[model samples]
Target: AEAGRFFCTAGRGLEPFLAREGLTLGRVRRVFSPKVDCVSGKVFFRAAARPGELRKLRSGERLFLLLKKHSPLPVSRNRGKMLQEIKSLVIEEPKYWLDIISVWRKLHGHEGETDDVSQENALALKRKSEEETNTTSKRQKTEQVRAVVSEECQVEAGETCVAPERTSNQECWIESKTSSEFPPKGSGETPSANEKLGFSFRVSCRCSGAIAKILTSQEIGRAIGITLVKQCGWRADLRDPDLEIFVHLNDIQSVVGIPLFRLPLANREYIKTAGLRSTVAWAMASLAEISAGSLVLDPMCGLGTILLEAAKEWPEACYWGSDISDLQLEGADGNIRTAGLMDKIELLKSSVKALPLPSESFDTVISDIPFGKKFKTTNDAQLLPDALQEMERVLRVGGTLVLLLSQELRRCVDGLTKCAGGDAAEASADSDSGAAPAQASSVDGNSSSLAQGGGESVLSRRFGSLVPEGVYAVSLGKTDAFIHKYRKVSAPGQK
Candidate 1:
């Protein structure tokens, strides 16, 4: 049960959130990349710890146990320089490299057994990355290519006693070949590269960055692979590699690691259909901070991803999710049934703009609003406002509203303004005066929109709308989204 340092990658803005969760799971060491979109952290944990806990992490995309770090190296336009540096590092510390790979193998076992690599899923990963980038020219070159070594090659190892006859036969064949064909490194004896020399195993390199023009990643990968085979007498298994090395180079440095999991950890069992990513769903749920017995609802639930995630965290909470589409509701129902949370959840076929529920009933509402891209819509832009109004009506005073939205945020706040009963005059005056106009509540306890002074949009008025407690802007590769946490103000001025 020895502890090891590891790193986890998360959506750009949610690194802090993920880091906090990592702290709960283990001792978090560092959360780096403050300026860049890079959101990653290192954690220390026991090698014997259940990986299921890592899988439980909803916000992390990939996790890796640290092997070796080469920090602050000079940027090399020449691919050979970088390859030579990596080669020297590997050749100098071959034993350390072997030990790290061995320990990773021992802990995770053969990735082939648990790693779920399907044609469909792999393609999906590529497509998701492409979508995140949203730039076909750049994406086509980088994200689309899946780097894998082919199975047909091998590196020649010295003959053993058991293979005496074959050894003798190949020995004659070996004598005819020049020693310079594959020269041993660090002996100061320089040898030229030969094309005809066959290896016992094949190596593939996949290169990236400005240096890609000089050499491909696959070419660099092969060079390192060749060096390793020569130094350690290791045989390559490219098709189902005994060891798989990933080398990623940027303008700054190269990150190299042996993957412990074949697939990203976000591929949870409960995810039947894709909608909100489990990580984002988990972030929204965490920000909501719902209690065990709180009444939670997802009015725009599609496939119940958000509710399901919440249910996992707060099993005792009363969960209700409704979708405008019957087909989507059916899908959500199946997922709920598969999760064995039928007793813990309620599914309704209802629109977000008008839920078939009593006013101020839900203690908390969590939802991933339709950006009109994933789900088809007639009025793509109007959904957010209408949904906000309906949600505010159903959510009780001081209730939390956790929303994952991609666009039309201004309109969303505008809808919340009308829902709070704030009128155009008050909204305008609130904007011009740089002060919130006095709010007047109706007999039913709803605030009136009208206030003295300039006529501004309701979005301009503060306390007149739902009180925003937290806002997280999430950058998921090519996609941009936001998670907003709001507390319904207690019946206008009553608070």
Candidate 2:
């Protein structure tokens, strides 16, 4: 294993979780934790790692090498200067791009032929002489004209025309690329014998902070691309490039690296019926702390994502997934077999309100309940309270219960806690497990559940036996959700 600096791309609140999980690996060192100083979805560290080792990370969406960290950049509002600064910073840096390039190759299953750059585009010269000679010359002339017209249009539309731009498909893209699209050019200089050749790459920039106020991601990416093109021996290929570089720039600092894979680590190939992101699902399971010989249950498990995550991480424990919908149960069944965890996980058809299992039979209950989209509460009754009661009923005393719920339901539970004169305790934003138990909030007397045709309030009955353990805020792109941890007590109103 080679020692190298790297960073993992995490969710907004998952920085600490990722850092902690990353440290659990052998020969990994923490360089910087974003939540400790800056609030971002990245964990910077150094590792003596290979391609296969980092892909096992469950908390982060993607991983990148720490190519270089720039010095404090000015809070420049000048768009032209900012683009120029970005270009100069990249090209001027003394970089060993080959080191990161080797890692990128192994990640894509290209373990061999990494030594010779010419092997990358064996047809580069042949294609350049035959198909691209005349046509490539013509396209360059047309592209220059298009650039002028595009800038004029931008200025007329009240946008900044700081840099010349290429056509949409001229550089890199998601589609396949033909050799004719990119011909190796060297500004009339011939390639040296030792010079690396035919390495195609694309630059992707993400902008935030003060610098973003001046330049868009597109402008920054183009500036970097123009500099890379000056390398004189490589092609810019966005679609199926040999290397992919990423630049995450802010007003104060710039982070540059290469992405490990095309798909994020959160996308699970084993579980085809994934309902929740595996990273978040793994976070949910971590809260449960399923030790060896533990019995875990996901009463409202849809597609069994939570159960599958738990089973994979803690093979010593057994899991049961129950769902009311036959479609969801069938999906879960297929996923269990596909993951090859048939002996570790089991599936059952059941509703959240009632369980077929005996009381206090399970050691932990973890679930990501439906929060009103793709699935809904049946019979127009609230699903939270019924879920809490049934989950509490099956979980043994002192067993952990973890739930992933929306903000609306969280407020409803918070209101119940306040009514009982107990303040809900929130864990620190950067906590490793992302959950800590709050003060015990319980309501006295018997109360009816929504699923039951009785006169009892579901909220009152749900909070009586479970003591709040902790809450973690998680971001899911367009929306935010919270993970709540609780412990079931032997007696009602007991802490």
Residue 276 alpha-carbon offset, candidate 1, angstroms: 1.9
Error of 1 at 191 (Å): 33
The list of candidate 1 runs beyond 4 A from truth reads 27-48, 109-215, 410-465, 493-495
lDDT of 1 by residue, 284-392 (tens): 8888878878999988888888888889888988999898789889889888888889998898887777789998899998888766555645353435445776787
Each prediction's Cα RMSD? 15.4, 9.0
lDDT of 2 by residue, 1-495 (tens): 556677777887777778778766643443232222223777777666666777888888877766777764676766777676777665532123444555566655777654566444433333333433577644553454344334422211112332655445443321221122223344566545523355766667777778777766766776566455433235555544566677877755688877776667888888987788888999899889799999999987888888888888889998999988999888988999999999998888888888899988999999886766557443212556666777878889989989886665565455343223234344423332212122121122223234344322345555667667787899877879888887776655555
Question: Lowest lDDT 10-mer window, candidate 1?
Answer: 172-181
